[model samples]
Target: MANMDISLKEMMAIDGAIGAAVVDYNSGMSLGVLGGSKDLDLQIAGAGNTEVVKAKLRTMDSLGLKDAIEDILITLSGQYHIIRPITGRGGKGLFLYLALDRGRANLAMARHHLRAIEDKLEI
Candidate 1:
């Protein structure tokens, strides 16, 4: 199993990865962060995406969808944001946030890599 720092480092190795963070959605706090560019503030990004996760979860509850979320992808003109909620034992309240440069990132491969990272995450 990968420790938090090692997991974040592995995420940064993904092609075109701009930044990555492990966050607690319940508190909107980043537990760990890495690789942010000047334009990206990983702390703020982590908080903002916490709202995204909460909103989707709330919607699912209201709609009575019993399924859990695998990931949420937000695509923009210049970037792509992926939010993956951690589902390991004791992982229910946290998530992995990844930002990628659209021009350089391979969405399919990035998704695959994120899954691998998630699988190995110890916490």
Candidate 2:
């Protein structure tokens, strides 16, 4: 399995990937981060997205839906943000976050790449 560094590097190789992070939603902290610019501080984004994940989980619980979340997509005028909760044993309570330039990204391909990365990520 790929280590966190390798996983983050692989994520950056995705087309239009602007930033990527492995975050602990339990603590709202990033375990690893890469590719973020001044315009997109990944640390802040990781923490903010933790709330997004938590809120969604709460909503799912309230609705009594037993299904697990595969991912959450947030689209903006210029970007697409993907939050994928890590379900692996070593990665419980964490997630992979990616930000992409909407015009340059292929959403389907990006999602596929993220799934592959998630499968191989060691932590």
Candidate 3:
């Protein structure tokens, strides 16, 4: 099984990966981060995305749907942001955030790869 460091490294190996982080949505903090530049601060992004996750969960509750979020995809002009919540027992309240260059990223493959990494991650 992989740990946070290994998971973050694997994430960066993705074709268009710009940055990656393991964040705790409950506290809006990053447990681990990698590959971010000054222009793309993973810490700030992680905190901000915590609100996004909370809002979605609130929406789901209001809709009376007992469902879990698979992931949230935000497509910008030049980038694609993926926020995938960790569903493993030991990973509750945490998520994996990835930023990819839209021009270089294959969205399907990135998602697939993230899922694989999640499966092997040991928190």
Candidate 4:
């Protein structure tokens, strides 16, 4: 299994990746992070994304949706932000947040890679 640091590093290797982080939504804290541009702060992104995850989950609950979220994807003109919650055998309240360049990223492949990473990640 990959450790936190190694997992973040692997995330950065994804094509067009701008930044990545392993965050604890319950506490709004980042466990590990890698890469960022002058205008992008990973810490801020991590915390902000926590709210996004919570909001969606809350909405689902209110709607009585029975489906579980695999991930949340936000597409911008130039970037794509992906939020994937860790559902390891016993993992709770953790997620992987990734930002990539839309022009260079393959959303399908990136999602697949993130799933692989999540499956092997050690909390």
**Highest lDDT against the true fold, candidate:** 3
Provide the lDDT at 58 for model 1.
Answer: 99
- Residue 9 Cα positional deviation in candidate 4, in Å, after optimal superposition: 0.9
The lDDT values for all models are: 0.96, 0.96, 0.97, 0.93
Q: Write the per-residue lDDT of candidate 3 for residues 41-102, one digit (tens) a residue.
A: 99999999999999999999999989999999999999999999999869999999999999
Each candidate's clash count: 0, 0, 0, 0
Instruction: Specify the poorest-scoring 10-residue window by lDDT in model 3.
Output: 114-123
TM-score of each: 0.98, 0.98, 0.98, 0.96
Model 3 residue 11 lDDT score: 100
To one decimal, what is the Cα RMSD in angstroms of model 4 from the true structure? 0.9
Q: Write the per-residue lDDT of candidate 1 for residues 26-104, one digit (tens) a residue.
A: 9999999998978999999999999999999999999999999999999999999999999997788999999999999
Q: Which stretches of candidate 1 lie over 4 Å from their true place?
A: none
Off by over 4 Å in 3: none
Q: What TM-score does candidate 3 reach?
A: 0.98
Q: What would you estimate as the lDDT of candidate 3?
A: 0.97
Candidate 4 residue-wise lDDT at 62 = 100
